[model samples]
Each structure stands twice: as structure tokens, then as C-alpha cells.
Target: MIRGRHQEPAGERESGLADEAEGFLLAHAHRDQARREAEELCAGMPWLTTAQAEELTGHYVRRRLDVTRDLLLTTALRAGQLRQEYEARYAGLRRALLKRHAAGVCAVLVCVGGASALACLLAR
Candidate 1:
């Protein structure tokens, strides 16, 4: 029998699937928007022949998609960098909190011990 095989929990699996679906939908929407924008842009120029307008629209959509792809890639990279930075900051803050707590505990213990010793000596 395999021991300690790691498996994604059902909730996480479902969430992953949902995220994938959402990403797909978002990409579709972006493509549609880009196409619409291209059409709108070509519409502004009434002199273009039907074939030229279509060609220009196609070119515009392609360029928009390329720009969008590049922007998304850059944003993803920056998000990853930000995540790493935030994690590091969180870890540093956690360590500092723990050290402060330990120091507090030690200070309390020292004060209590000193007071107890003084009381005993005075009573003797």
C-alpha cells in the first residue's frame, strides 16, 4: 500500500476547476471585445472597401491579442513577484512577533522570580 500519497482535497480541486473555467471565459470575453473594438475602429473609416475593412479588422484583432498576451504575461510575472515579496514580509513579521512574545515571557518570569526571592530573604 502506498503511504502518505499527497492528494488535493475536493474543495481545492473544485476551486482549481472553477478558476480554469473562469480564465477560459475571461479570455473569450477579451477576444470578443478586441474584435468589437477592431470593427468599431474600421467603421470610423467609411472609405475603406469591404475587403480592406475586413483585412484591417483582422489585423487589428491580431495585434490587440498579441498586446493583450504580452500584458497578461507581464502582469502574471509581477503578481508572482508580489506574492513572494508579501510572503517574505509576512514571515519576517511572524518571527519578530514570536521573538517579542518570548522576550515578554522571559521578562515576566524574571520579575516574578526576583520578587519571590526578595520576599523570602526579607522574611528570614
Candidate 2:
């Protein structure tokens, strides 16, 4: 059963142990919270066993994770949509600015032409 156990690197073993410890702590916290919730719900009713409470807690945690994931996905999609809308608006504004600049240049040219014509008539 332990034929290749000695072949594992020391760092790998240490990391595995650390991961296990962390998982145990996290699970304990979840279980404790579950126990509290179950106790409240089970008040004035039949008591639940430790195993039952743990099972119920696991279900609660799974549902919570699913909801959190869905919320994150929705938020990310909305953010992408907002970014696209703003970018489109920025492009539209840039086009409008260029058109205004062109109109201003044309107006300047027309004024210069009128002034030059008046000077020529006066000289004649």
C-alpha cells in the first residue's frame, strides 16, 4: 500500500500536510456555523445528530458557492457590456469633434476669401 511513498519529494509531502491542515480548519469553521444554524432551527423539535448536521451544512455551503459564482458571472457580464457601451460613445464623440473641426476650418476659409475680394475691389 505504501510502495511509492518514499519516492515523494520532501517539499511535496510538506505541502500536502499544510493543505490538509488548512482544509481541516476551514471545514471545522463551516461545521460550527452549520451546527449553530441547525440548533436554532431544531429548537423545540427533534435534535439532530452530528453527522446529520454536517450533511446539512455541506449542502448549505454548496448552495452558497453556486450563488456566489452566478453573481460573479453576472457582474462580469454587466461590466463587459458597460465597457462596450462607453467605448462606442467615445468613438461617436470623436467623430463629432472631427466634423466640428472641419466646419470651423471651412468657415475660416470663407471669411478669408470675402476679405480678399473686398481688398481687390477697393484697389480697383
Candidate 3:
């Protein structure tokens, strides 16, 4: 049983290798599928030559990249706008809180002073 247990690691290593091979095969398959789809698309347009098909694919890929770049830029701009709004709100809230705290302190001081004056008069 001890020997069998030691052999388990070897089995696991082989399984790991199999998994890696499967992943490689899957990636290749996906590339082939995309190529096939592109070929079909080119075939549908009988006027396009093989070179033109390749060029079209390149153009599409570039367009996709450009769109993605634009999307990222838009997202960043929106984020910045949101951050500024939040900061403005935070500053306003902070100022309000400070004013409230100051008012509370003044009320406390007045109460203490009034109580002391009453006490002094009563003692006399």
C-alpha cells in the first residue's frame, strides 16, 4: 500500500501532462475554427481573392483593437468624472459636520455658564 501510495504522484504527473496537452490541442482547434469561419466568409464574397481576404481579416482585427481602445478611454473619463463628483460631495459633508460640531460645543458652553451663574446666586 505504501508503494502504491508513492506511485500516485507519478499518476498525477502524467495526468497533469495530459491536461497540458489537451489545453494545447484546444487552443489549436480554436484557431483552426476561426480560420475556417474566415475562409467561409471570404468564400461568400466571391469577388475577394485570398490576399484580399487576409487583408480584410487584418482590417477587422485592427478595427476591433481601435474600438476596444476607445471604450477603455471612455471608461477612464467617466471614472474621473465620478471621482470628482464624489470628492466634491465629501468636502461638502465634511464642512457641514464641522459646523454642526462647533454649534454643539457652543451650546454646551452656554449651558455650563448659565448653571454656574445660578449656583453662585443661590449660594449668596
Candidate 4:
């Protein structure tokens, strides 16, 4: 996360807080899982000294965290790219739809005005 001080509106601040909380929870869960896996691996190798097992578990957790971080970063980058692409497509489609609607409205108005003029001429 980029660290900078900027005042946000209440709604946005709340959203940011929620996002932070969610991230914290997810990080904790990942750490817990990694530790559990490390402990299990250490458990299986009963011949290792206490210091060695601790070192191995620490290394394993660090590696797991690094891999997870990299994967999350990649996913976030792809998601951002996808969001931009979809937004651009949506904007283009919206413009086209608006143009078609305006044309249809103009056509309807012209038809109505012509019929009104014809009726007025017939009445005279």
C-alpha cells in the first residue's frame, strides 16, 4: 500500500478502513496457515535439533509469505488492467447508445411535426 496522508470523505475513509481490516485478516490467516504447514513439516523430521527445526520453520514461513505476496501483487495488477479495459469498453458502448437514442428521438419528432403540418393544411 502506498503511504501518504490525504484527507478522504467519510464514506471513502470508511471503505478504506474496511479494506485495511480485510487485508489484516487475510494476512493473519495466511501467516497462521504457513506456520501450521511449517510445524507439520518439522514434526515429521524428528531427528532435527530444536534450533534447526525452528530455523527451518522460520525459513519456510518466510518463503511462503514471499510467494503469497508475489501472487497477490500479480493478481492485483491484472485486476487493475481488466478494470480499465472494461471501463473503456463500457464508455464507448454508452456513447454509441446515446447517439442512437438521440437519432431515434429526432426521427420521431420530424415525423410528428410533418403529420401536424399536413393536418393543418387539410383543415384549411
Winner by lDDT: 4
Clashing pairs in 1: none
Q: RMSD in Å for candidate 1, one decimal?
A: 2.7
Off by over 4 Å in 3: 1-48
TM-scores of all models?
A: 0.86, 0.60, 0.61, 0.87
Candidate 2 has its poorest 10 consecutive residues by lDDT at 37-46
Candidates' C-alpha lDDT? 0.94, 0.78, 0.81, 0.97
Query: In terms of lDDT, which candidate is stronger, 1 or 3?
Result: 1
Residue by residue across 1-124, what tens digits does model 2's lDDT show?
A: 4876566688998999999999788766765676566556555345767677667666766665566568768999999999999999999999999999999999999999999999999999
Q: How many backbone clashes can be found in candidate 1?
A: 0
* Residue 31 CA displacement from its true place in model 2, Å: 12
Q: How high a TM-score does candidate 4 get?
A: 0.87
* C-alpha-based local distance difference test score of model 1: 0.94
Task: List candidate 4 stretches off by more than 4 Å.
Answer: 1-6
Q: Rank the candidates by TM-score, best first.
A: 4, 1, 3, 2
User: Distance from true position, residue 81, model 4, in Å?
Assistant: 1.0
Per-candidate clashes, comma-separated: 0, 0, 0, 0
Summarize candidate 4's per-residue lDDT along 26-120 as a digit string, tens digits.
99999999999999999999999999999999999999999999999999999999999999999999999999999999999999999999999
